[model samples]
Target: MKNCDFAYYLSNFFTTYLPGHLNVSENTVYSYRDTFTRLLTYFKDERSVPPDKLKFSHFSRDSVEDFLKWLENTSHCGISTRNQRLAAIKSFFRYVQVEQPEYLMLCQSIISIRSKKSPKPTIQYLTGEEMKLLLEQPDTADRNGRRDLALLSLLYDSAARVQEICDLTVRNLRLTSPPVVRLNGKGRKIREVPLSAPCADILRKYMQERKLDRQDRMDEPLFFNSQGRNLTRSGVSFILAKYISKANAVSPHSLPSTITPHCIRYSKAMHLLESGVNLIYIRDFLGHESIETTQIYAKANPEKKRAAISKTCDDSSAPKMPDWNDNPDLMSFLKGL
Candidate 1:
């Protein structure tokens, strides 16, 4: 099949069957798109399809298996990543099978390519001290201090994923009786989370300062740079990194490997778990499709890990051991032998 045609079919299948039947979200559709791009590049290199003659049948069971191997050995991709790619490939093959029953045999075998289950990477979050420095790091003496405080507060207040927080518009934020934020999560699924008293007051002050009339047709982003435009994701990351960097100077929380938007994600979940919030509520907060995914942070944390080891293990508590080599009974037996 032509590359363009194949691409069109893939999109159609994702839109029609994926969302309609499988109940996947828009973010999922986006992931499949990325997976296919990687798959094609691999196939092009292997088959030398420089011109326009790579057919769908080029994807045999063995070729698919080889791609799986490449995911680990060559790309060094993680388990979650490899599973997503495998899912995309399976979707494509399933579509082809429906179109051409002759490919049924091939598709059936591809279904057996199971994803290996592994514990998710441990999520890193701020220690209590770290969060203290971060919140306090925003210069309250400056004009942007309140705004910075509000932005950081809102991110943790709702336990929102970074993408969901970045995509917010002015209309999405509500500081009324419910004190809610309308978050557009993965697959464009919208959920409302409550804002704290401090967040509401800070945002109120910032909006009043900007003279942002609700009636005005402002097409710009909700959070603005100094020039007044929506804050880019990278810009937000840089902003957080700035504070994290300063905090790390005082404590180890700001180490390069330890800080990220996702770390903030972990921070919020950890806060909720410690606060005795229900896991289901946190699942809704994080916009995760399942509670199983959210439960990772609810499990034992780093401090808990250390505490567990200390509580359960102690060298002084161990049973005394005999030195059989130096014992007189063993020495006498050896001499007789």
Candidate 2:
């Protein structure tokens, strides 16, 4: 009815506060918008609170908790997804508290609700042999095959997110003495990742063939589909899946069934770590804000851990202690205790 209403504030929150004040990306804004859409849907279906009649007071701590539970139980969302929705709601309420201080207690209650703990996901990556098999799957003689080879090579070499690869323009490439590709990462952060000689060679040829090396075409996407548009995430995944299937057909265990573009990134990171690359450099390469995030690669690496353990001592020369159960004095002492 008035500008002070929940609908009014919600509208302004998306249109003004997120974009104007916070300067969040379009993707982020869309994600937040989706969360609110789901929230409204939950209210309508579960609580019988219609969209227009929904108020800020409807988002009480108990109601928010119930919605999260509904997401898991009824909606079949994972813990991470549930946490993400909660985070989005919390962010909105935080903005509301600043604008409408009268609802401070309610806002604080929702904010105080801790995120549910989710188990750390195992980082799936390709091994060197598996990577070799995958890279060889594409028929390099054909144009599309050459493109796929170049795409896979760059995907692994740059250790980029799928979105970063999608965002790549012709100008982002610099095939100089030390070739590098500029990756636009999350939070508007940019990082330059050095490409391997093979990767650079493939990219150089792909660009030359597509006329992307021309100054006029600098704004063009580095990789495109049959439609001459930049490859979407699903497009890239589809390409990978096709090759993965082929690779697996040849050697049944060459690649994992669940391999995605992200696995290529993880594979690259693992390869670098296995090669003794410093975590700091890996962090910068992967565009991670914290070294802790990069450390997951190191932690997940069992080979590195095994190598370290192997170097600690020679088992053959180590002194052996008597078995406690076989020693009469030790057994008597244990019985007394």
Candidate 3:
């Protein structure tokens, strides 16, 4: 007889039930699997026992507290990551409580472990000069350049995630006013995103260069590689990296390296928000299921944070921390770590 029931039940829930009932995308399934993996690893190390020996009977509110602490202190996870891991555990227990009543108390207790608020990550964006430099860096005069230009330009204009952008076909683009581009986004849902005029114009140039007679199979990929196959996700990243590195100073602490196709997505999101676009509109435009996800950008509003911080930081009245070098204790602690 096992001491706990999670091993047999939770495994089945994730492997079979979640897929069938949740209708989650493959990426989402993989992400949840990773969360369980991290959870199991934490359990084994923190409890001084192997994961297989861990049972629902062994789970406790104190253990849940330790699990959260482990996530922050030992695993060095951010608040969002820790919260997500807790969600995974909660969902697993929900499944367990339904199918395996022996673990009901354990499942219920973990719900008490409340998730904390995480600091919003700062958004880095490209300046106008930088964007112009990157767009011009690629030689649109050549065949490869034309293809790469279309690829990068689409990322910038659509503000699409790399995955959504890669799934694109020529048919998805409207090439007309509001220049509707059908975005096949996360969770297999589709949304039509209106393209800015600049994006539409750049895309028009690429299509003209391709000389497609409109007879080209409607299902064919919009962006193809040199060998005439669909361009890969990594290939797009590689192209962005090469150009950004060449066009910018390529510094250790600079926005150029960070400004990839995803940056273009972030750029559009921030630009729209700063322009006072409705949050609901931006949510639909980005094809995000949760408005909570879109709200991360509100906190990630770089210009506002910088301006607010700048004035306070420049204050002569603000007390400065002692230099690390001047503090022997601080220097000793740093060395110990």
Candidate 4:
């Protein structure tokens, strides 16, 4: 078999094009890398095409589609995840079209592969009572419990993404007058969200107790596991699940069946919308790129809809109608029809 430039193109795409030219975040690069890694593995294990012998010609439209199907049937990936992998492949091909114009037709075919549309996800969130119950599940008496309380409080208050919470450093916090926590969100965007007084106090106490407030430890992680290392996404999920289980055990129907870190963020946004906070403010607070994303909470809130309808309706000014039976002309017209 002739030597192929597939390896070379893939190498430059990740090491140069994505990082230097596109300026995508490290996390995004990792995701794209994973997509290709799985794709190569599929080709090797399924098609018997080893990485070294694989050419750009192998990634045909049908090949890509079959790979997506394999991801669903074999890997059991959801539609959203399949779409994400497809997107990564499309992105690389788009770059390929520019870098290697000779492969333009091939690239165009791969790029034309459309993402599978999934149903709009119903945003899972805790109700006010459920959130209160879950928050109270962590005992504040013990040191670990105190930390858990502060962690959960901050998670809700900032409406931080799980990754953002995991990435938080001691330096990201400012628990002084008018407290705020800096969250580094997706796409390398950073936003400072104000903390509620209670959340601020909890954080301040937790930091002081753990000696995380020291200038020397400013660069250290804000949240840690039992090993005192930065808490992973799985670790955070485990913490939330533990509390959710305890809350559900205590009061059978008080909490949702399963509560993840993201549910806490959604709960905060819902609570804020219910409080009549402006959608624009909620967008910034949640580090959302658009006000449209923040509007989901408003659309989901029944109270807001009820309030809106109540303001438009006037029971006293409504005109009364005569009974059809008593109105001979209307009865005759209806009979004629």
Count of backbone collisions in candidate 4? 0
- Tens-digit lDDT string for candidate 2 (1-337): 3523799889999999998998888778888988889989999999999999888767789999999999999989999999989989999999989998998999999999999898999999999989999999999889999999999999998999999999999999999879999998888888999988989999999889988899999998998988999999999999999999998788867678899999999999999999999999999999999999999999999998999889987989888655666766976757655
**Cα-based lDDT at residue 267, candidate 3:** 78
Candidate of highest TM-score: 2
lDDT of 4: 0.91
**Quick one: how many clashes does candidate 2 have?**
0
Give the TM-score of each candidate: 0.79, 0.92, 0.72, 0.90
What's the C-alpha lDDT at position 44 in model 4?
95
Q: Candidate 4: lDDT of 78?
A: 98
Question: In candidate 3, how many Å is residue 70 off?
Answer: 3.3
Query: What are the RMSD figures for all models against the true structure?
Result: 5.8, 3.0, 8.7, 4.3
Q: Which lDDT value does model 3 have at 117?
A: 84
Model 4 Cα lDDT, one tens digit per residue, 1-337: 2467889889999999998998898899989989999999999999999999899878789999999999999999999999999999999999999988998999999899989889888888988888889889998988988999998999999999999999999999999989999999998999999999999999999999999989999999999988989999998898899898898789867677667899899999999998878999999999889898888898888889999989988989876655666657976756654
lDDT (0 to 1) per candidate: 0.75, 0.91, 0.77, 0.91
Best by lDDT: 2
Q: Write the per-residue lDDT of candidate 1 for residues 88-137, one digit (tens) a residue.
A: 88887888678768768978889778888978576778766667678877
* Per-model tally of clashing residue pairs: 1, 0, 0, 0
Candidates 1 and 2, the one with greater lDDT: 2
Model 1 stretches with alpha carbons more than 4 Å out? 1-8, 14-26, 143-146, 217-220, 226-229, 250-257, 302-337
